[model samples]
Target: MLTAAIGTWKLVTGRADKLFAGASEERLYTELAPGKNRLIYLWGHLTAVHDRMLPLLGLGPRLHPELDAIFLTAPDKTVAELPSTADLTSAWAGVNAALLAGFDSLTPAQWLERHADVSPEDFAREPHRNRLAILLNRTNHTSFHLGQAVLAPK
Candidate 1:
């Protein structure tokens, strides 16, 4: 589980770095495609989700709880405006750095432990829903959006 978690994080960061490269702070508000989310929104959403994981993994509180409203769910620019690109970028770096530190501190047994909201009974019933699994799922989620992020230049 530890190996899988580390490997998935590596994959996620690689895709994210490539996507963010050459990204323009000015062009972030532009839609990647015709009707999809703006490039900035995707970056903020991923940052918010990863920040929330801090609490879920018992690392610390979310660095930007304000982002949860617009980021936790699907993209909805009409509902709420996102923060500036610089702010989101800082939060993204801080959250990810903290996550890596926390993950490194966890023993293999802790990786198998249930995450924040899952009760013992529920965890026993659903062994696949452990903290390691959540990391893998979120990594895949980041990669999926990274695919959309690459469309910013088009």
Candidate 2:
């Protein structure tokens, strides 16, 4: 489980780095549509997935609770008010590093422990599957959005 988690996190961080490489500050905030900004879209999706997975893994919310209140606003929010593409990329890198560290510290037995509150409808086959499952899903999810974000017009 530890090996799988580390591998998945490395892949995720690599993809995120590739996604933002050479992107200009102007490009980060550019909206493809009116009232539909790129930073907000990407950050919101990332936050939402993290919010879901963190609780399952017994981690605190990714961002502060007060910040979440702000993000709950209609248009969503940028990554911690990052005003430039470079800043945004740096922010993502920080998040990736933290996730990598957290995943690396988990033991195999901890990964397999069942969550008592998991519902039958959850996609995970059992309440106590490998914690790597969450990391894998998050990595895949981020990759999908990063692709979309790249393709989106500035």
- Using lDDT as the measure, the top candidate is 1
Which regions of candidate 2 fall more than 4 Å away from where they truly are?
32-40, 51-55, 59-63, 66-73, 76-91, 115-125, 128-130
- TM-score of each predicted structure versus truth: 0.89, 0.64
lDDT of 2 by residue, 1-154 (tens): 4676567667765765655554555565566456665744565446545555555666544642332443444455434553344444455555555555666666777776654246545636766444656667667887776766766565
Q: Any idea what lDDT model 1 has? A: 0.80
Global CA lDDT computed for model 2? 0.57
- Report lDDT (CA) for all predictions: 0.80, 0.57
The TM-score leader among the candidates is 1
Q: Give the per-residue lDDT of model 1 (tens digit) for 19-55.
A: 6634777677778888878887888788888888998
Candidate 1 clash pair list: none
